[model samples]
Target: MGALMSVAPEPGWPEPEWHRPPVGGYTADDLDRLPNLPPHTELIDGSLILVSPQTAFHMRAMRLLENRLLEAAPPELDVAREMTVTLGPRDRPEPDVLVVKGEAEPRQTTFQPEDVILAIEVVSAESEARDRNVKPRKYAEAGIRHFWRVEEDKGLPVVYVFELEPATKTYVVSGIYHEQLKVPVPFPIKIDLTAINRRQP
Candidate 1:
């Protein structure tokens, strides 16, 4: 039998090494290769950014909002949750809830910006900045007509709606609703926020 020999650990062993890909180089296809991604992970400007985890309250509010949006959306539109919307070669954001122009095909990997009519983001403490500022700017520039941001005020959801100004590619405040979300753009619809909050209990 040969004498036993011990191998020394390499320098920086046990320390995970990170390779930084060039900015604006990553595409949606690259994002698809990664598996077991966290629920809120997103690709922004070719950077893989892991979003904050959703609190129970945030998820409950998101589900309630989705249900309301679905009930109000037109027959031609479909409301989905946490589906990636491809904004560009380097931008793929997964909105908390979104309304698309038509039924989603089974093999669809991502929704195109033109196909997304409305994008909604529910604010968590950790996601406030991106949800309120970053996403709105990107979604508007991508020509998504409507955007909604849901914020918790006194443990209740308050929704702020915005509509895109096409010429400027910017969003203008459409309405802000606390007890109810009522709007006519895309279609006429009313969501009773009070009722939704009651269901949380």
Candidate 2:
């Protein structure tokens, strides 16, 4: 017996059966187990959400943030890009960038919400609503401490920072940055937004 995903699909090519959802859709645990799923596929409310092709801005910005975060992160924490955090039995959403407590294992694919300290989403035209509205709310509800939403402004990056309000299970805006992002929680950090100008990371 062999797994459906035993052999990797070529770039831009997914398994033909990838579009077919399970009888009840997919659950959080099914993401790694399902062979037909393309990389970066996410399960939201038990439905698989296929990722749209990446734009240059989206690609560059995400990588820049990931690199800057890895550099600024404390020794005890880890930073990963495009990794899913398991929020519940039926919910698993992949953030553009995430910071988690403790060291990363060799094959870990998901992080529990409690282990994620920060979840960052860079807004894309197709996912603006979910990035700005849905995902942050869910991250907060799961008790993740911090969230950041990055949006484009005149072709530059603008970052919005939020802190979880434990009492209400919601996020409250802590600050917004247009050029540089300097934050104290998660870790003391400073990022130069202009670095995304090169258009690739």
Candidate 3:
């Protein structure tokens, strides 16, 4: 019993290496098999990235947008949140919101790129770069027809919508919207940004 007291508390946990890649780095399928992974873990360019905790604005905005999209979506389309799309062997990213074609299986955890018509990212301070640039490029490369990145401005959402240019396999800025997001592609969608995070009786 005395010996136990003699041991000092361990140093601040060293930089986590368990999520580090092996000889050739991680793969998309590895995400599904990895044990004890934090929820919403993403594989980006063969590196496992545990995303930052979402802000209150993020959660409310995401829910509001998802609900609105669901209301406006066509019968054949479905809206999902925080679901991964396996873009390639080295890339599987979970978007904040997705508009996917057809019905998903009960046990489906990942979707194929071809099935996703729109992937939306709600930008958080920590995820600005990835949300604005990295994700769009990958989504476009996989031929996803549309993408949206939402930014917070004084507690309101400002949406930037993009469309894939097949000739270059790149994304072209479709529009930047504030207050109201109205779009015609990938089926019509209109949202009132001010409604996000509003208190309801």
Candidate 4:
């Protein structure tokens, strides 16, 4: 007897069939099984939302911010980029940058809300509403203590910092920084946004 083999699709040809989620929607487990998902595909209330691709400016800002945070973070805390934070059974958001407690363990897939100390999102044209409004509410409700949003204005980075109100499960603006990002929570650190936003050669 010979072994059966599946035929591969020809170059430049689409697959004969594609897997689609059920009418109800895809669960977190279902999303986890799919491979080759576009970067920043998130599951929110069982609906998959594709976050827009990061612009070159966004990438540079994120890298610069991450490096600064990593430098100031205490040994008990760690910084990560584009890691999934599980908010609920159907909510898995990949924040642009995040600060978490302790070092990363091997094979860690997603972070629980409690495991995260701060979550940062850089607003993009496509995700402004979600980043500025929707995510803050959700992150607050999940009991994550701190949040920061970076907005690009006139080609410069503007940082907004927030802290959670435990009673209301909401975030209140702590500070807004234009050329500098300075904060006391999660350890005191300062970042020169102007320098970070400068074009790299």
RMSD of each: 9.0, 5.5, 7.2, 7.4
Report the C-alpha lDDT of model 4 over 14-127, residue by residue, as the tens digit: 653313556776666655677655555777666677655568778888988898999999999999998888898777877889999887788876898989999998888877
Clashes in candidate 4: how many? 0
TM-score of each: 0.85, 0.88, 0.89, 0.87
Number of colliding residue pairs in each model: 0, 0, 0, 0
Q: Which lDDT tens digits does candidate 3 get at residues 1-201?
A: 000011222488543344455877788888878776667888888777776767898988889888998999999999999999999999888999999999899989999999998999998877777888888899999999899888889999988889989999999998999988998888888888889877631
Which residue runs does candidate 2 get wrong by more than 4 Å? Answer: 1-18, 199-201
lDDT of 3 at 37: 68
Model 2: ten consecutive residues of lowest lDDT? 1-10
Worst 10 residues of 3 by lDDT: 1-10
Candidate 3 clashes between residue pairs 3 or more apart in a chain or in different chains: none
What's the C-alpha lDDT at position 109 in model 1? 68
Residue 72 CA displacement from its true place in model 2, Å: 1.0
Which candidate's TM-score is highest?
3
Query: lDDT ranking from best to worst?
Result: 2, 3, 4, 1
What is the model-wide C-alpha lDDT for candidate 4?
Answer: 0.80
lDDT against true structure, model 2? 0.84
Give residue 107's error in model 3 in angstroms.
1.0
